[model samples]
Structures are given as structure tokens and as C-alpha cells.
Target: MSHPPMRRPPIFPITEAQLVSLFMQSFAFGVHALVFAVCMHRWFCRFQIAGLGTKSWPWMVVATSLFILGGVDVSLNLYDNIIAFVFFKRPGGADLQFETISNWINIVRSVLYFLVAMLSDAALIYRCWIVYAHWKPRWAVIVLPTLLWLGAIVCATVDVYYVSTLHKLATIPHEKTLRPYLFATYLMSLLLNFLVTGLIVYRMRALSKQTSSFIRQQRWNRLKTVSRIFMESALMYTLSVVISAVMEMISNDAFYGTTDVSVELAGIAFDLIIIRLWTENTREESRTITESFIMEPPPARPRLNSLGHYQLRFPPPPSRVSFAHSERGSVHTNISKVRRI
Candidate 1:
């Protein structure tokens, strides 16, 4: 008689899943580092060209903080993995180490993740505000998103408190008390990102329409290009949060992997916008220079007159017209006639 296959031990999946998460986290960290480097290079180039300013300082600080926090978070994850796989000499193996709710490294990683999410969301809101700054009631546009961000802050604080208070070694699935706060935090962030991104995109589209009549077709195309970039970057972070929230709700071990990726992706999303904008600005400047050179007028050639002397012919000056708008909204046009001697 054929024997039934032996069942796998509970520890098998825990160890395997954690290992997968560790590998994925490391790979993402590599990408994050490379992006961070490029971002810094672009920022420095901009600084050199434009010189130091208050507005530029804030962006540099934010990008640097995000990179530092991401690095620390990934390092803590690495330490936890090493402890679970190599140093922990216990009967339960890696599962015991991973399931320990009170692990210090795990607690720190959770806090870092929450911090990064908040920072990224705040940056998105700032971008939205900047885009709408010219509107009469600009603040009204971001009120809802700002409120959602505050709610997220409260949820994240509570979640961190709960995680810190857990004294026992237990599986995450069994922690019913913490699920609501965690879910709320992720849900709020998801909504905030959606709203902010939508608002920015709508504003861009509106501007495109408003300027279509007066602006060059090339400029309209540039606006579309910018809108596309913003959407692509925002979508990257939004999808990561969506996957994370879904995984967290289901209590899947894969949540660890996705959450790890989300941390790096948050920074990547923010930095990507700056990098792409800088590139676009550079391309536009180059194109402008090329057009100026191509459209430049040719030098006037010297002509030999009947007196055998070289003479240069100059073009006649054009008349000028100026428009003035009165307080009552009436426009007055004045034409200046050019007189030739």
C-alpha cells in the first residue's frame, strides 16, 4: 500500500515566508539607494544653477530624511532576519523569533514605516496645494485631504502604541485588537493619496484647457507630459498601498514583503517627480536654445554702390502699439507712428 505524504511542519512556512520577504526587501533597498543618488545629483545641479533658496532647502531636507529613514528601516529588517536564522538557538526556530510581538527591531521598523507613510502623504498634499495656489479659495481644495491625513496620524499613533504594549510572543494573525487601527491607517493613506493625486491632475487638465487658446501647441503638449508623469508616480505609491492594505486585512504572511517594498517605494515616488521635472526642464532649455539659434536673423551683406564704396542697408523700424486697461475694464489702444528721415 502506498503511504500518505507527511504533512509539513508549521515552522516551514513561517521561515520560508520571512526569507522571501527579506530577499525582496534587500532588492528594493538597492533600487531605492540608486534613485536617491540620482535625486541628490539633480538637486545639487539645480542648486548650482539657481543658487540657494528657502524653497529648495525644504525639498532637500525631505528627500534626505526619507532616504535615511528607509536605510535604517531596512537595516533593522536585516538584523531581525539574521537573529532569526543564525543566532536564535530555540526550540521553535525562526517562527518563534518572528512571532515575538515584543521584539525591539520589529517595533522600530513599524514606527519607521508609519513615519515614512505620513511624510510621503504630506508631500503629496503640499504638491496639490502648490498646484492650486493661484485659485481664489485655494485652501478649500485641500481641506478634505488634510483632514484625512490628520485621521491617519491618529490611527498610526494608536497602532504604534498597541504594538509597543504587546509583551507576549504571538503570531500577527492572532492580534485582533490591533487590526482595526492598522486597517484604518492604511485606508486613510490610500484615500488621501487618491484625492490629492486626482486634484493635482484635474488642475493640470484645467490649466491645459484654459491656455489652449493662447499658448503654443508645443506648450500644451508639455502640460500633458507633466500630467502623465505626476500620474505615473502617484500611481506607483497608490498601488503599493492598495496591495499592503489588502494583505494586512487578510492577515497574510506576504504582508511583510509588500510592506517592506512600500517603504522604499514611498521615497522612490517622491524623488521620481523631482528627477523627472528636472529632466524636462533641462530638455526644454536645450530646445529653446536650439530654436533661438535656428531662428536668428542673418547678417546684412555689404553692397558696392556706383561710387565704388561699400554700403550697409538697414531695415525700417516698425510702429508700436500699446494697450491699457481702465478700472472699469475698458481697454484703450494707442498706436505710435514711425517717421522716417
Candidate 2:
């Protein structure tokens, strides 16, 4: 008896893009959270067994904090999307269109995600410092990574200023004043990733060459593996950033959601350090086990028992024997007693 008036399509069909971003982000978050849990457990367990030292233990705390923060930020983003789809919109009026990408919630979420990246990048810089601190020219080696880290943070801060003040993201690239900062932020992040990753790889390989022990070489190799993983990860996220930025800059559409990949990968990179740490610690344990098997001492030679030494020859001074012979039978000799030996 009653029918609601039909509503026409809105100006934008970014709903599909929004949905794609939402579920992909959610899936990446869930997978990395699970990985973080597993890696955290293994990390602590291996640390306990393998002996947690001063230098690496503190970094472990930092890594955990970054992972936790990234998870929290992503959770907020998912909730923001849930609100957009489930609660914030009317069914018929202006609800036909997807939520705008530049909502305050999205802005806040993006800022937090960037904070996580900043923390991860800072950790990378710390690693570079520790690796090169003892070198001939220490501060000179540190200057580049330090600058990259600070530059990324500063650019992110400027970008955050814009994000906080605006409610729509599409206008960000066109705003002549803020556009350069936005581009610089992503560029700085990419640069920081490459710089720190290269430093780590170089330092670790150099360490491997300097150390004579097989175990130490293995340890360096493990650290180098972590650097490579993070580098690859950084490249992935950097590409996502590039694509999203390019698409938005050129297309004049509000449907570019590929930047979500960068958010997901940033979170994963933090937990990846833990995963690699666990691997390195377990490798040390395995090396110990192998060494034990190879370097065990030989068994001791026979010692004196209750009877006497078996090595020396013994001579009998006197002995008594009895011989018994039977018809059509073989003779047998039995020794009764020995007088001396």
C-alpha cells in the first residue's frame, strides 16, 4: 500500500572503491595481527632461551609498540568505514553515493598510519646508527639516514596539518600550496626506506666479512635478511603510494583506493622485524646443537676393574692339572689351581 520514492544515483560511484579498500585493509590487518602474535611469542621465547641482550632487547620493545599502534590505527579505519556504510548514511536521500575519502575520520586514521610509518622508519635509522657507530667516521655515516628520517617526519607533519583542516581529500592535490608537501611526504618515505635499507645491508655484509666465526657470519646474514624484507616491503608500499597519488592527480575521480596497500604493508613491516629476529635467534640455537654434536670429546679408554689390568701380560708360576681318559673316548684336561701369576 506504501512505496518509497526512488532515489537517483549520486555524482560519484566511489562506493566500489571504498569497499575494495575496506576489505583489503581489514584482511591485511587481520593477517598481520596474527603474524604479530605468532612472531611476538616466538621472539620472546627465543630470547629467553638464547639470552636477550641489551642492544636488541630495547629495539624489540620499540618494534612491538609500532605493531600495536599500527593495529590500533587500522582498527579505527575499519570502524570508520563500518560507520560510513552501516550508520551514517540515509537509505534513500543523499545516501546513494559513497562516503567521501576526506572525512575527518579518514584523515585521523591516515595520520595514525603515518605515525606508525614514522616509528618504523625511526627504528631503521636507529639500526643504522648502531651498525655504524664504531666505524672510523661515525657521525658522517649517520647524517644521511638521520636526515631522511627527520625529513619524512617533517613532511608528514605538514601533510597532517592539511589533513586535519580539510574534510575532503580530492581537493588536496589541487590546492597549490599543499600539493607539493603531499608529494614530498611520499617521496621522503620512499627515500628513507631505500637509504636505511642499503645502509643495513652494507653494514651487515661488512660485519660478515670481518668476523671469522661461522656463527657470527650466520648472524650477520640473518640481519641482512631482515633489511631485504623491509626494503621489499617499503618498495611495495611506495608503489601503492605512487599509484594512488598518480591516479588521483590525473583522473579527477574520487575512486582511487590503492593507497590502502601502503597502510597494510606499513603494519606488516613492523612485525616483520620480529619474525626475522625470531628466525635469527632460533638459528643460533640450531648452530649450538650442531656444534655440540661435532665437537664432543672422544670416549675414555678402559680403566682398572675389579680383576686387574688387561694390558700387561701375565705369567703363571705353577698350575695343577688332571687328565682323564676313557676307552674309545677323547681325553680332557682340567686345571685345578694356579699357584702364582
* RMSD list, candidates in order: 7.8, 19.5
Best-fitting candidate, scored by TM-score: 1
Backbone clashes under 3 angstroms, per model: 0, 0
Q: Write the per-residue lDDT of candidate 2 for residues 118-212, one digit (tens) a residue.
A: 77677667666665655668778768767777887788787778666665534343345556776777677778777777876676556545432
Model 2: lowest-lDDT 10 consecutive positions: 332-341
lDDT of 1 by residue, 51-85 (tens): 43334667668888898998998888888889999
- Cα deviation at 62, candidate 1, in Å, is 1.4
lDDT of each: 0.77, 0.59
* TM-score, candidate number 1: 0.85
Candidate 1 accuracy as lDDT: 0.77
